[model samples]
Target: MSDQEIPAREPSWQSRRLLSDRLDWNLLRTFLVIGEEKSISRAAARLFLTQSAVSQSLKRLEEQLECALILRRGPRFDLSPAGEEVLRLAEEIYGNVSRLAATAKNPQDDVVGKVRILTISQVQSDLYDDFLIQLHRDHPRVELEIEVMRSADIQSSLNQKTATIGLGLCRFPQTKLERRRLLRQRYAFFCGKRHRLFGQRRLPLEALQGENFVSFTSDQLGGNLSPLTMFRDQQGFTGKIVASSSSFEEIRRLIIAGYGVGCLPEHLVDIDLHNGLIWRLPPAEGVVDVDVFLMWNREQRMNHAETVFLDSFRRLLEAAGEE
Candidate 1:
């Protein structure tokens, strides 16, 4: 046939590329949340959805899979055998998606993107200042946001893409994230200049056992379990916890006011110690080692700038550990 006489051919389905899949992927996500939480209400809360919505999603998933995924009782839910199988598949899909997302992210100098980082404890803020300085110096166009939150929220932030990185003392069971150890932060007991323990170079733990104490809530450390929790769990201390706050600034001020001896981050109290504003109580056997971690989304690929920042931060942590 001549070029002018050629017939127009229609596109075939086999040759067409689908931008979206036919299967309901959201159903699997809901299924995974339900399996992990073990309660529809809890899963709904985590998903920022209504109970009915979560239940509906589950029902839809069950219908599609042609199996009972959950057995509901009074305020509790259990996964059925079919649910267990579906869960395995869901995990595999989730893992693959995460890998794809990580692979897709490429470092670009244009279109300034915002990165939110969460901190588990104020203790890590000392290092954050230096890191921020370096970040600005390297990537002046990008905006950096930091949130000081509980460990639970930190993990949630990373999972939900609300935060790019988390610096915390506690670890959560997330199969989709990666962690880098920065340093093991140690705690030091602090008292004001006028307090009786101020003049002493070092004081024993027992010396302040009788002193009224200033303590922080678990929120300050980004975990529901605080170091003080360790004291109660292991020591069976029924004693009243005198003063409590979640802010490091508040704790510092309270300690300065001679409210009581407070457990302070070594880095935070360093300048104060040099100026004789606060004194450290002697080291004890019961000191809890706070392992500082740099948590990031394993599914998301690090860009050139992000990779450099992460590497430099890792190096700083390594240096601190050696010191």
Candidate 2:
């Protein structure tokens, strides 16, 4: 048989051997981060490693896989077809590893590991202090990563498994997530001490008909309608809005500066009300009520640290209610 006519051996065996080779899990983790962030610098920042180290790790990973996984496109990195397939498999690998790590911990050991929480900004201010203090006291080994996000984003993060828990105003239907009512946040009209109606006990709703009001913007309020609009439509308020802000603190400051009367959550202004810096006005007919919830992905398993933090949060709420 001529040498050229001999059957050529397929590369299947070599490819199978490469597939069976054990890769470093840490390197895979770095690759996953780079894949998700699409920037070596960003991934390095997230992983708390130097940019050069991440670059080297990526090089090593490609060498091990024996294929070019990523292609540099101007300022960003795009995954090659092989990279896409690897990323999909890497996600499953990491997901199973995470679940295994959660359950494989010694049952007798103290609660440990990181719990990522996503909450609304206002809700964080109201509860994080107490929650963090209690968490540290009870489970010193547990680390927390709290991100302030909009109410609309909180549930999405929970469903994506990016956040282990969420605390926010429950605006979505409870179809895919588990929700426990945490508290009823009350919103009512407020005025600074210098306001005309500050000293009055029972000012009528009609009295504010032409007054200017301060409130949060629609986006900040996490709804289609602004708080000012809700009050105007539901409580017979006819005030003109003089100012709007994305910051709750800014709105409070504006109200205190006598910019205009504003609606604020009771918890936010409780101290100001006590200090005589702000006064809570009578609701036109009733105060605006929002039900805040503790939410999580229904399908995810809660690790020990997460479970402990959740239980402590519930207790704190109960204690606050008693007071």
Candidate 3:
């Protein structure tokens, strides 16, 4: 055959791999890392991948989408509008895929793998201490890792597969994770001993008006109504929050330090209430109530250890219900 007359060969399977036909899980992760970092080099460091590899992944993603996902400018890069949208959708898809994969994996009998549970500091303080004490006593073979993070982090932890379970005030959105509402959380408005409301048998809601208040941040409000929102809707709540924070510990200390009247979960401040360190605001109709949930990503094929752990957790939650 003449040098240029030979028939052209078909593209190699590797070259013909269709991005649309198969999802590249790593591509979504790479997109998220790069979007968060805004620099491929930085993302590469975070992902433990070479800059060149990161670049290749981006190229694949862009080629598959037939659009520029990122705009390179000098030493920096930013996602285009489309890229931002992709990132959002990719995150959702990644979460779903992870859940599917997790459920499909065969369980190991020994169950030696680490299990991560995400929760808030207060939940840990009020409930998990007893649970963990018993867990260790009964299941010494199962190693447990607990992460005390915010509610948002708890959601993200389960969403990102960083934690196998999440225990928090709010239930996760529709996902593969099964959420069981464990108990109702009650909040009490309270103030230091020096406050007028402290000595009263039951302070009127309006009486709280004009009183300086310390409160949780909007995010920390979780699914419950914000204190400010409660005050606006309820009569007799004339309190003014001079400071706000999401940290339960900080809020506790602030009230003790005489910052302002604050609301806290009863379990969190039960001891303080008894010690006279803080006094509850008189009960009012339609007070804020929160639902606490225990969420776990279930495996399609649960190992013996995983099954046992889940059962133990369910039992603990059930016992909490009795209290």
lDDT of 2: 0.72
**Per-model TM-score versus the true fold:** 0.55, 0.59, 0.63
Q: What are the root-mean-square deviations of the candidates from the true structure over C-alphas? A: 11.9, 8.9, 8.7
Give the distance in Å from residue 225's predicted Cα in candidate 1 to where it truly belongs: 5.5
**What is candidate 2's lDDT per residue for 1-323, written digit by digit as tens?**
32112232343667658755667778888988888778889999989999989988887777667666787766666887778888877776775565444444545567876678887766634465767876788777777777886676677656656567888866556677877777777778888988888878878777776778887775234472354475576656666778987667888999999988888778777789889999777764345777778888777667777777777776776677621
- Which pairs, if any, clash in model 2? none
User: How far is 217's C-alpha from truth in model 1 (Å)?
Assistant: 8.2
Where does candidate 3 have its weakest 10-residue lDDT segment? 1-10
Model 1 bad stretches (over 4 Å): 1-20, 95-118, 121-123, 139-149, 152-165, 170-236, 240-289, 295-306, 319-323
Give the residue spans of candidate 3 off by over 4 A. Answer: 1-78, 81-109, 124-131, 171-176, 194-197, 200-202, 219-222, 225-228, 236-238, 284-286, 298-305, 315-323
Query: What value of lDDT does candidate 1 attain over all alpha carbons?
Result: 0.66
Model 1, span 260-283: residue lDDT tens: 877777766778879878877755
User: 1-323, model 3: which lDDT tens digit per residue?
Assistant: 32112233444566567745765778878987787577888889989999999988987776656566777665666677778898887766665554443343334433433455677666634465676688677656665667786676576556555456777756335465677775677777778887666678756666766777787775233343354365444555465667877688988888888888877777778788788898877555434666667877653334444566667778877776732
TM-score-based ranking, best first? 3, 2, 1
- Choose the strongest candidate by lDDT: 2
Displacement of residue 202 (Cα, Å) in model 2 is 3.5
